[model samples]
Target chain A: MIAAPRKLPAPWVLRTFVVLILLLVWEIAGRHGSQLLFSPLSKVLTSGLQIFAEAEVLEALKTTAWILVVGFVLSVAIGLVLGLTVSMSRFTYQTFLPVLLLLYAIPQITVLPLFVLYFGSGPASKVAFGVSHGMFPIAVSVIAGVQGIKPLLVTSAISMGASRWQIFRRITLPYLTPSLFTGMRLASTATLLGVLLAELYVSAGGIGHLTRRFGENFQPDKLYALIAALSLMAILINETMRMLERRYSRWL
Target chain B: MSGASSAGQALTLRLSKSQKRLSLLVKIGVLVALLAIWHLVTVDEFVSPFFLPKPDEVLRVFFNIIVTGQAWPDLKVTLFEFALAGPIAVIAGGAVGFLISLTRYGTRAFEPIVSSVYAIPIIIFYPVSVMALGIGPESKIAHGALFGFFPMCLSTIQGFSRVDPLYIRLAHSTGASKSQLFWRIMLPAAAPTILTGVRLGLMLSFLAIIGGETIASLEGIGHRIVWYAEGMQTGNMFAYIVFVIMVAVLMNTALSFLEIRRGRQ
Candidate 1:
């Protein structure tokens, strides 16, 4: 399949072209198609700013953001603690790692109602659910980080008279930083999933409620606008995490 | 002194019989403690019984549903969506991914877009999906497939593009045909990574379908759980949740085992 190389458009140009074509198609379809089914990008963009003025939508966004932040912070804390604890000894690691993995594999969605039941159909349930979804990646990442260090390095560190605390601080902490950040990136994604899923499933209040209302009323413009806002939030969070990860790991 | 310290480190890690037993004890101890807490909390009414049904009540509900086959129709619906979605996602994703991987420039062009889109929940599309597909199995399948496709596509691209360059050079020097290089060298090399993607894609398909059903569907396992919850049949709801969790775990375990086994080959 070897052939002479041919000219290709710049990546960004191609990407922009692809996006533009899709938007053009969508606009055409929206014009000619059922109003019940589609909204053009222009309509969504115009209506998007107005959504921010609504107290209910603003409140939902605040609630969702708060839940995600609190849940993410707590998850990182718990994940680090559990990961460090389990990695303390080989026996502990061997014994408990599988158990932790099994728990991680169990889709947290199944227990969304259970969370709502236990914590009430409020922010607490959503936060708890987000924590559950978010914690595992960090925990697993930390575990891998700990276990990945060479035994020879540990032996040498001990030989040099590194105290348990000092060894952990000097050796493990530095090693874990990169993974911890990457795990945070992954955890952010999961946290968003858990919070959004709970919010959507219930539809009593918050972004989910507003979107459900919009859907029922066939307000496609508002629905698209809401989705776009949420997606922008997601992208910002992830991109920030990525930048943090890169900045930290630049030396490596 | 260094030797002695090294010896001590080795000793600390040694999994002696008593350590294994202690590990087992800790594992069982944790489970017993959790169950005891659940039992005590409900029995002592530390929490309202309305919210926290006793374990036996949950079990009874689970058993009764199974014996009466009440779960069958819901299970069937979920499974049908999964069946329709999973294969469609895999084949389509794999094909698209392979094409993207054909050139490094192509990968650079599209990979970022795929990954960035992947980070977004995309579940926001549910309301639109429900609207368009009318709250039927069609919406679930379509959304589930869409959800599953990205993971498969990402992994497939990773699998092909990340193949060792040295091997490709060797194959080329030996005058291997394009197809021969792909099938004989590339496929096997990429099989493990691709399998992982397929497994994840399959898992995601099931999860997406369940989530869709939970949100807006009239019937399915997820719908039934919501139905029970809304009706205040907490025990029945717990049963369905347990049933779904078991199904998910079993499939996940089986898929992992399949991956590990294939990896050996």
Candidate 2:
């Protein structure tokens, strides 16, 4: 028998090494680089407390988080209600989905000014925008989940004299759970985009205010630190949602 | 119950024509009701009218610009950003993705890294773009290209690398040249997925340009809205919002139409 070829090391090991090389290069380059360009990774690590210790930074972080939670909760509520209502009858679906599609098609960023104009540069506007972004995906996902039930199952349930509420609770709810979780994951992403985009646009307050301040101050180390915080938040949100989605989807 | 449902279905089929008309009427009714509510709420001052200008006033501003041909210059700047960003995103993203996907080893080495970076809303680097390119159309173009590149690259890598091994092996067995195999087998198989990436990239570019302009710009459609908003020209700002929405809608419809027509071929 031929001797087995040596297997390569795991992919993650390779990935880590690649990252280390890039970071080394970045640090080396930054040592000689212009002030506007970059900060060494060493500097970024050491400056973490400088970014975290600022009270205003903490407040902005809280504001962003609070808005995201409010928007996400509202999205779940509205998406379920609206999605169910629109899918109530074939007529309603035909009447509303095309219009919904039209609304969804438009780049929502176009309306940022209107949202800011209406809600002021407050968390209210940020929450509203996040809900707007988050709700559509949830609604779309719910509609898809509701539509996915095979006709025979519905027919069988009706034949067994199931009432509307029974039909929903026993049949529809379980079927929708996986998709709902999936929608939450997507909604989380969209909501983050919307809230962050609004914050960035406002630039008068919140996390965006800090970013603009850092950039203008030409403090690349602090700028990088603050951005790294935002990136960490984004990854945490996404990973949490992904985990929940995965857990619920095992039955599916 | 199944038979009754069949009868219900037959009934719907018979009523399809009238239902279609009824659906249109319902849709129109919904729009009318929404507008009426907007008008009444503002008229009643239930909420501050500052939050929502009158619908008629917004419409008037919308038409005045169209009739007077005032929206063209702003549209030109935004579209120019689009035209510049779109090619860079497509060509560079596609090439980078293809190169990374050329070997399984490369794919394993890079795909996760690229995807994680994409997930971070690297748009946070808008300041970096602004710093590098300054507050102008060039910045928007660069911002758009950078933001748009991720989706295109990710999808292209997915598309090319995931083609069936069976197809590749069959082509090889048939004495197919590398170019022949790529052209005849890989291209067709990957076309739909790659096109999906391209479409996403296109949309992202549009959004990024608008976003970059929104954050900071001297001119562009997004800037036009900010200009009016800052100046307290609410009516005109509302009109520009509607105009931009219409443009978005039209572009998407045109894109879908093109996609369908091309898909058939």
Candidate 3:
């Protein structure tokens, strides 16, 4: 297995080459293939740029963004508080964790209608849905973070006359940071999913309406461009979370 | 020292038993409280029945739908899509993942791309599937299979890539045939992780199928809910939601049971 001596292109170069080829194929297929289903890359890109310049699409995007931000921030805040309180004592943890797991396990999509029914088709429903999706991972991870701290460290701190606050501040906080970041990364994706699902389900206004309009009207170029823009936004948010996770993971 | 430790262990065990009982009591209490609150909110029109149907009404509608067999067609469609998608995802993903794991360079080149793609919410591609496959079960199946593929591929790559080299070396020295070496040593070694991937893939495929139907399907369980909601049949909609949740929970439980049983073996 080790006998062969060979040289190969670097991984990044290979990846770039593969991507370029795929793009080329897509462009060709769009031009030559069925006009009803496919849009050329150039057309999609230009449409994407043009749509961003439109006030209507911009408003929709802004609404979506607002819901995502609000929901995620609320999730982090609520999740931290809940996780900390639950993990504060064995009784609370035992009593509450199964409930959280039960709620989490429910296929939340089933309740999309209910959410819209209660909160209407506006931002309120989307934000609520996003928080419901995002908060669980954070709370579970935070509990795990607290639980994972070595008892020996706490004992040693106690022997050195550290107060409870001091022990928690020094040991627990640092230990939790890495896992907390990991939770945030997971939460970011979940929140986006929840918000987007709500948006799409409503089909009244915002990104969902735009997509449906584009799809039904047979505007493949506009449809592809809109999806691409949303995907780019998702990637940027996900990458930021991933970077934060990596930065904090050094502690673990 | 042994006697003292044994006594301590017994005490702790007794304490744990009491704790378990207490936790169960608390759980039951919490559920009851939630149901009570829900009832209270609807009792005197504190909340609109149009928005939140009473528990009794929802239960009646649920039973009515089940008894009338209104749910059968949608249920069948959903299950059919899941069955088709699940196998497609497993075979395609497993084959590709196995091939990738055969070379370190292949694993290095593809694993990151696969994972990053997985991170993006794949629902964005639903419209594309609709465009290509139309607003039918085919699109839902395709979407589900695509969604399920990533986890299966990633886990399979991870499972095979991390197998102990020493075990392979030992098999080779024993002059085992290639097929025997793979089937006996590699397959069993990788089975647990691969099984986990399978479970995840099937679950995600099921969820994706339902989600796809919700997004743009003519008929299915998800579509039924949307239809009811648009018609403002809140009671019936609630009933459908409850039914779907039950199905999901049962599927999740059954998968977990299989995973645990196999893990024990």
Candidate 4:
């Protein structure tokens, strides 16, 4: 039986109203609550600005950004190449896919200490850790994307006298773009998580060290502000990639 | 003509089968080659033992840890924290999500906020959690719950919101009470999605707890790795890493099985 259509509520207006109310409540609660856990919104705002004033915090931001970019690029490039090679032949896919998945399933975090041990407590360890974490998702997604191509499509192209290069360039590349974008999105998040976690763990030089310092000093305001800033950066990067995914998917 | 064509096809099939066998051999050869290289490099002292311990040493250490039962306490603590955090996250996330889904407007109002906040890796708040809860299992629990909460809540909302309205209307027309309607219609319909959320939450909860242990604290699997690493006990660290990965895999498998069972019901 066909169900009668129900009216969906006005989502935008309702969401806006809820957000405003939450902000108002937060402002009031922050203003009145104990100073330890709840810094007023205004105080946090000012402290956030002051955090940017510190050269070290700015440097940490720069370092984190650089690692994220490098790690993400490496993961995508390596993943794409490996994925293509493995998917090129059914024999390779059968022989290697299980092994790849086993490695992927292992909590890479378990070997994070090994990474630090081998690479030392430097950006190298962090980048290596990030790459290890980020590469798996991209590889898995790319394999899925490549393997998902219908055999009929390839057969049809071959029957029409399309050259190997022509088939790959025109048919395979376009079909894989959406999956590639999805892989990038996952890789970006994984890379950020890996880099940030490694940075925090190493605690020699970076935001992790700064976080430890603030925690030890009981500089809750500074710590809160710093975390907030980093969270915003993460959110911004995530949103930008999400937007790109949407835009690309629409064209596809 | 038919015999010749069949013979050609058979030859092609045999050629493909041999190619497959060759590829399998190559794959195994590659793995063995890698291990050989690792052994050689470490034995030659080109790479420091501290940096990359020989495979034999790692295996010996693993055997020692297993024999001595040195890893039990850390394993227990990590499991204990996970046991506590997983249920709390499911209940809290589910209750809150259910409340929010009661009204059409509420679902629209809260889901976006929940999802956007979730998009940010909540691990950044780990320090804050430590500050508030101190460096112990409590902070880990808090972090785990927070990490697990978003996915659970989002899926719960999706689950309940997608419950067919026709069922609700039929229940009401049949003079079913509010309690009966909710229990018979809403909860049952939403159970699969809710279970899916719980499964996702369980996985994230373990990851966050391990992360929290690694970043801080004196206990748990993650802490054990760091503890051994700092002590320059490379072999024990490798053993603990294996143990942790095994536990993660087991937990994931169990949860997915539970999800499938619930979906069937």
Candidate 5:
């Protein structure tokens, strides 16, 4: 029971070693394996630049980015409004909360086809899908944050003669910031998934179309490169949001 | 001023149980009203049938699909993919996690790599999968398994690594064999976290399978929705969408229940 604590090893050094070995193995396998089975890292890197030079790929990436930004902005605005409205009044909360939760619990991916049908396989569909996915997390989290405020604080503020508006501004809003940021981080990821899924489903324009083209043409190298680029974009967005969450959550 | 004060006091009175019941009723009422409005608008052509089919029409289509057995093959494909992917994810994740948890050094070396990768949305690799595996169920299964793998592995590692050393020490002192110690102590200690991982893995696999079908499948529930939508049969499309959502909800609920039940023991 009183066993001494185990000495922790150097994590980064071991990680680097493992990664290097894996990469080397992959490089070797790519050289020996069938072209269809694998593309060497060097070939992929060289052809990757060429794939990026394609105008359609560039345009598709821009369109995806635009949709992500616009949809996220709209989701945050709408989520904040709906979350606040529901949290403000017990009547509204009880009357609408269940419905909101039911909708949120539904697997939204199932409706991708319907979204495309209604929005005509355009940017509208992608943006709408993104907004739908992104809004729920923010709404749920914001409601939780608002409802979780310490009761004593509210009472004390009122006792001190703070106006309703002042109480909301000085207390509730600030209290909810950490949760709001956490929700936004989650929402951003969901939004990205929704928009990307919709875009991929449409397969008529944007990144999805390019991927489809590459897949059909058996351009594995190009496909891998393109996907890697998109993944990096997703990682960047996620990391940035996580940083913001960490920064704001410090107060808690 | 006295009357206003009295009114304020009266309004601040605690809610009765009946009021709580009434609020539930109101919530249901709002939902029903929303559906009613939907029905009315669609029936009246205020919204185009193509955009939003009537609820009755969707129900009729649902019945027809069920009666005609149109959904069976797609259901089989999706379920098969899910079945294959789910178990693969569990076993692979368990193995990797077990290996990582064997020593503090392994945990230090691999845990961060696994977790950081897990933090990113992994579905972005679907295109590469589709490219490698083609547009069939193979791609879907691969995509689903990959999506499910990260969470399962991470959770399993966390579970095993956090097992109390006190139990291990006691077992060792009691002349417990390695296999017996593992079965009695390690397995029981790690079961809850592993179960959580399995639940998450199953859910993600299901979602990824559906997403794969939507993206590029010749058949499956998702494909059926897209087919109906493209054919301007909005009613059937909506029905299929509802059916799929229901199935997902049921799957998630069942898994959660199972997890809770297991956790108690």
Candidate 6:
């Protein structure tokens, strides 16, 4: 006799259930726990909604968003150019790859204060920090992508009388797309971390200041709301990058 | 084909010796050039000394801090917090990951959820931690533990769940007991991936502790860097920054060595 098919909830349904249960626990804990330390989900939700109406918070968010975009774009451009240049010849790749890895290994937070000193406590410093954090992953990934291109493919293209430009555009570009996406996805997270770290470190005004204020003033609701918003933004950016990576990686 | 490949490999190996020397020379050349440029700009006053202190000054101050033991207290605080957070993250994350991987449905349902949460900048919750745990080592430990947890958990899940079922089946067929099966088959199979996760977790924990200190704490090496920066003592700040980088490099090097050795075993 054949066994009956097992019925199970979908992952999303289970996820929703998990979320609801968590919210319930949070609500109960917040109400019963220290009011000064924790805010209930209801209060946090209300405050989260209210923050959008605050002009100061909105302005700070816009500043952060603008800087994040600029930093990300700059990192991608620099990383791609540098990656291409170094990977052009095996000699250059051998000479420079270790340097890049060494620099990458250096815990960048140490130099963050130096960034602020040079760039000042402004968006410039944030962007610089973000670029520093984001670019290495891209450069490394790009190098790997290039190195992984089978020599046989290049030889065949050469035999077929494909010019350097055509060979690159046809064979290399498509092959590198997935790796580039992977790098970008990692870079996005790193960029966010760098920018946020800079922001949190010494912001005269912006989300950093607001976070400090909320924490110091015992405004747990507002603090939770602001964090939830930032977390949401991070989730959206990461998910978008992942989706793009998946799409491009399908060819592999 | 084998002969041709081996010959090619030998040729490449011979070429690599000279290539390695050339790379080292280039690396040294680059470092010297950067230092020269740094000295030139600062000495010529092309860049403000306040902004970019001379390499000599930074080096002098770095030695001063070490000699005077100015960094010891802050270093202790940072290390103490790391000590507490790193182990907690590894154990808790590993345990949870193992539990989740026990059932295929659990793995499918929860993996995405955990990863999605992981993608969120958990640093945004720093303020909440600061508020709840106060502006002390407790907050830093909590923050570091939270930051390290996701990687540890994800890697553990990936490691255990992906273990070859054939090995487990063979063990069972050989009359291996449950604990014996786990100890002899599953643990060895999953060791490398789990060790990698542990390495990542520990590194991130240390970094997060420093980051937390930079953000809000009154003590720790990160706070000292900020303190000097705010005071506009660029020389001392640069010194602390250099010291912190050295510590990080050392820690990461040690962890990588451990990972390699254990992975081989």
lDDT of 5 by residue, A165-223 (tens): 99899998998898888889889988988887887777767776676677667776787
DockQ of each: 0.48, 0.45, 0.42, 0.45, 0.47, 0.48
State the displacement of the C-alpha of residue B170, model 4, in Å, after optimal TM-score superposition: 7.7
Q: Interface RMSD values for the candidates, listed in order?
A: 6.5, 7.3, 7.2, 9.2, 9.0, 6.5
Share of the reference A-B contacts seen in candidate 5: 0.54
lDDT of 3 by residue, B1-56 (tens): 02234223333423377888988999999999999998999988798988888988
RMSD of each: 4.1, 4.5, 4.5, 6.1, 5.8, 3.9
Angstrom error at residue B105, model 1: 1.4
Off by over 4 Å in 2: A1-6, B1-15, B39-50
Better of 1 and 4 by TM-score: 1
lDDT of 1 at A105: 81
Looking at model 4 chain A, report the run of 10 residues with the lowest lDDT sum: A1-10
lDDT of 2 by residue, B63-123 (tens): 9989987999999999999999988998899999988887777787789888776767766
For residues A177-209, could you state the per-residue lDDT of candidate 4 as single tens digits?
Answer: 777778888788888888888987888767766
| lDDT of candidate 1 at residue B21, scale 0 to 100 | 92
Q: Mind giving the per-residue lDDT tens digits that candidate 6 earns over A121-184?
A: 8789999999998998788778778777777899999999999999889998898888889899
- Give the true-contact fraction for every prediction, in order: 0.54, 0.46, 0.43, 0.44, 0.54, 0.59
How high is the lDDT of residue B105 in model 4? 71
TM-score of chain A of each: 0.94, 0.94, 0.93, 0.89, 0.92, 0.94
Better of 3 and 5 by lDDT: 3
Which segments of model 4 are wrong by more than 4 Å?
A1-9, B1-33, B43-46, B162-190
Model 1 stretches with alpha carbons more than 4 Å out: A1-6, B1-14, B43-47
Question: What is the DockQ score, from 0 to 1, of model 6?
Answer: 0.48
Top-TM-score candidate index: 6
